[model samples]
Target: MIIAVGSQSKIKVTAVKNALCQLGVKADIEAVKAHSAIAEQPFNQETRQGAINRALHTAQLVPRAAFTLAIESGLYWRMDAWLDIALVVARFPDGTCVEVESEAIVFPSSAVEEVQRRGVHTWTAGQVLQEWGQVQSHNDPHLSLVGKSRADFIQDAVVKLFQTLQARHLLSV
Candidate 1:
């Protein structure tokens, strides 16, 4: 099987590999550049759409692949605080798709202020978190807050999505 991933980021690619391993499916995985079709700092539903768009875009790049996976991280406002969420979209060869999301972690008010009040990207906030020694990677500052490794968070979502696909009989190992 061939699995195409939307982003070239190591964390995303590793998550895909880990998820596949968890499912006991062996395949060649490739990472391709794909557009999210949303703002650099997407929120809520926009984040979900970005993941879907990326998966669709990746599917276009590798149409013969058995599955295309897109993973996107974004911030959302909830209960007067900003929280981080990772959205995953998996597109099958038959034009069917499954979506899943990670548990959210609250972002520091300062980091949220940088994005909301200063028009800075969430990645920039992640950089700030890195400077403060609160996070190790700019791509997943929630790693610090949630005490979960970046790959683990992403893999969890992908695993759930694949499980859903299996339950629906849309995927088989």
Candidate 2:
């Protein structure tokens, strides 16, 4: 079996691989450096759509893969704060699709502004945090601010999405 991932980022790729293993699904992964065609730090529904776009793009790139996965991180404004979340999307060969999101982390206003000032098209919050030495490249910054690793949250979302697929009879594992 094969799984196609829509990113070359090591963090995202590892999260998907870890989720699949935790769920007892064994498969080879094909990682593609896909462009979401949106702001790197997408906001609102753009984040979700970014994941979908990536997954769709990966499916096109690896047509024979059994599944395609994508995870897109973005910020949403709610309850007077900026909520940073990673949205994970999964696509099956039969056109089955499902999505789930990591639990959000509240980013301090300064960090949010720093990301905004740097230009969303050019930098993601994680990259800004990386510049500050809060995290490594392509890793999440929530650990420094909210005590949660990027991979943990994203892996959790992927696990939930795959389970949803299984429950819906769209996936066997």
Best by TM-score: 2
Cα RMSD to the true fold for all candidates: 2.1, 2.1
In model 2, pairs of residues that clash are none
lDDT of all predictions: 0.82, 0.84
Could you tell me how far off, in angstroms, the CA of residue 6 lies in candidate 1 after the best superposition?
Answer: 0.6
Give the range of the ten consecutive residues with the poorest summed lDDT in model 1. 115-124
Per-candidate clash tally: 0, 0
lDDT of 1 at 168: 90
Q: Please give, for residues 61-140, the per-residue lDDT of candidate 2 as tens digits.
A: 99999889989988999899989888888888887778888898887667678988989888777777778776655455
Q: Name the Cα RMSD for model 1.
A: 2.1
Residue lDDT tens for model 1, 1-173: 78899999888888888887899867899899999978777777888889889999999999988889999988788888887878888888787878888877788978767666656443456776777787888766766778777678888888888788788986677
lDDT of 2: 0.84
Candidate 1 TM-score over all chains jointly: 0.88
